[model samples]
Target: MNSTFMLDGEEVPFTPGQTVMQAAAAAGKYIPHLCWHPDFAAHGSCKLCTVKIGGRFATACTVRAAAGQEVDNHTPELTHKRRTLLQLLFVEGNHFCPSCEKSGDCALQATAYEMGMLTPHFDHFFPDRPVDASHPDVLLEFNRCIMCELCVRASREVDGKDVFALSGRGTGSHLIVNSESGRLADTDFAATDRAAAVCPVGVILKKRVGFAIPIGKRTYDIAPISAQPAGDPDTGNKLEETP
Candidate 1:
């Protein structure tokens, strides 16, 4: 028998060096997480993937899966915690989903639905974040950023361009462009770069292409968020392409 971990009573086998999140995703088990891309190292900032391992709490993305370890996911307490996190994210920014361009295609919006978040319980921050439209082909919708850091990782690791970074700390933290003018146009970002496609929200958009597929026919609209593929867009589990 292969080495395995007990995930909610189901046996989830894992390979050497695999994490709980990785093994779970490979087994087609859904675990809530963000700021974790297979292409880059796990960023435990999101705290959405917390799971109980042998009665102790741990972040699934960073915790290595070992044989015979008992893992508890998909429990009422965990769901409630996730719901609160989703609600906080909603009220932290001006997430006007009804009028938002990424209503259906956005991961943040879809995740809220998956977590059963019906309302933004907290008061809205309504921070006056500015949009960066200096880029000729792309727009940076700063207000929509959830600070997942996918764009930062993709730009630096995949595209080999240090075009993005998070500035400040705590509530003051924000995404910044790597340019003297603090404008994306001043940096070497392209529409085809990984950073452009890695945003899980409507923070990055190709100009003049708003709602080309329409709201009702969008990606998440066709299926619930749970129906979507797991992990940071399947980058971690993808098979290597022969060049």
Candidate 2:
């Protein structure tokens, strides 16, 4: 028998060395997260997955699962905190979701909806980040970047491209292309690269196919993200048509 832990009053089984998020995912329990992917190492930057373990808060993606431990997830307090975090992410970036190409299929947008974030509580930063359309095959819309570093990690570890990187600190942090010309065209990034596909928001978008899938017919459009099973971990948002 596998070791088990309590999550939201239910038992979730886990193997040795699996994190709480991994175990919960394996058990078909959804833990709201933005920066975690099953294919990559846990980078606990996005604290949306913070859960209470024996009365203390910890990021589920980073905390290892242990037998008989009580994990509190989807509680009122944690839900409020997650809503605040999602609100901050919304206000920090110029996210015009109604007009964004990634509207219905966006993980961030879907998660925000799941958390019931009605409005951005904080004042909008409205930072003037320019779009990079230098690349012929891809469009770099910096306005929607949540600084999750999923693209950066995917590019380096999986695709071996080293094409994307995060620069700056704190509130000033932003994504940048790894090239002398400071443009996506200067790097070896392609439309099919993992980096191009890992953005949970509308940041790294492919060109010429913006509205290929109608807004109401996309991934999250058919089903709320929480209803989707945790087994398929590609991009966290199902944008590609698997044939």
Candidate 3:
């Protein structure tokens, strides 16, 4: 018999070793997480996936759901906390959503809207970060990075290239690219690699495809990410054909 655990007060069965995010996603529950992408290694650095497990705030990416464990999937207080964290994320970096090409479809932007974030309450950092546009097909905008590490992990685990890394420390920490040379074009990174595709924010973007979809027709413009069908875009999830 599969072990059962309480998810949002209902009993659900899942394997032991799977992380809480894995278990929740399997059960069709949307757990707000940024660094726990299934295609990459879990970096648990982003506190966005924090869940009250066993009465403590624990990152879901690192926590395992044990048998018979009672886990609260959603609560008013938890939502508030996540919103506050989102606010911090907004102010910590240079997130000019209006100018970003990934604005509509970005996960961070979607999560911010879902959390009802209107304005960043915290003082903005506004650090001047260098941009890497030397790559032929990708643009690395370091200023907009929230240090989610999805790109870093995708490079290492999915694309078989350990190109990106986190440098510096504390409040000033940010992403550093490519052998301390600060150019992604100088590295072995290919345009089609998963590393170039895993960015959830506008930090790393496809060169020409950013403006391809056009305004009022992008992913989020059509529907909020919560309303987006949770399936493969190609096969399981069908794109609506325009008349």
Highest TM-score model number: 2
Model 2, runs deviating above 4 Å? 235-243
The TM-score of predicted model 1 comes to 0.93
lDDT of 1 at 73: 92
Per-candidate local distance difference test: 0.83, 0.88, 0.74
| Root-mean-square deviation per candidate | 4.2, 1.5, 3.5
Estimate the TM-score of every prediction: 0.93, 0.96, 0.89
Q: Give a tens-digit lDDT track for model 2, residues 47-166.
A: 999999999999999999999999999999999999999999998889998988888989999999999988998999999899999999988899999998989999999899899888
Model 2 error, position 167 (Å): 0.8
Looking at model 2, residue 102 earns an lDDT score of: 88
Clashing pairs in 2: none
lDDT string for model 1 (152-239, tens) is: 9999889999999999998888899999999999988998887887787778888766766677867778886666666647321111
Minimal lDDT window, size 10, model 1: 234-243
Clashing pairs in 3: none
Error of 1 at 110 (Å): 1.0
Sort every candidate by lDDT, greatest first: 2, 1, 3
Clashes of 3: 0
Residue 71 displacement in candidate 2 (angstroms) = 0.5
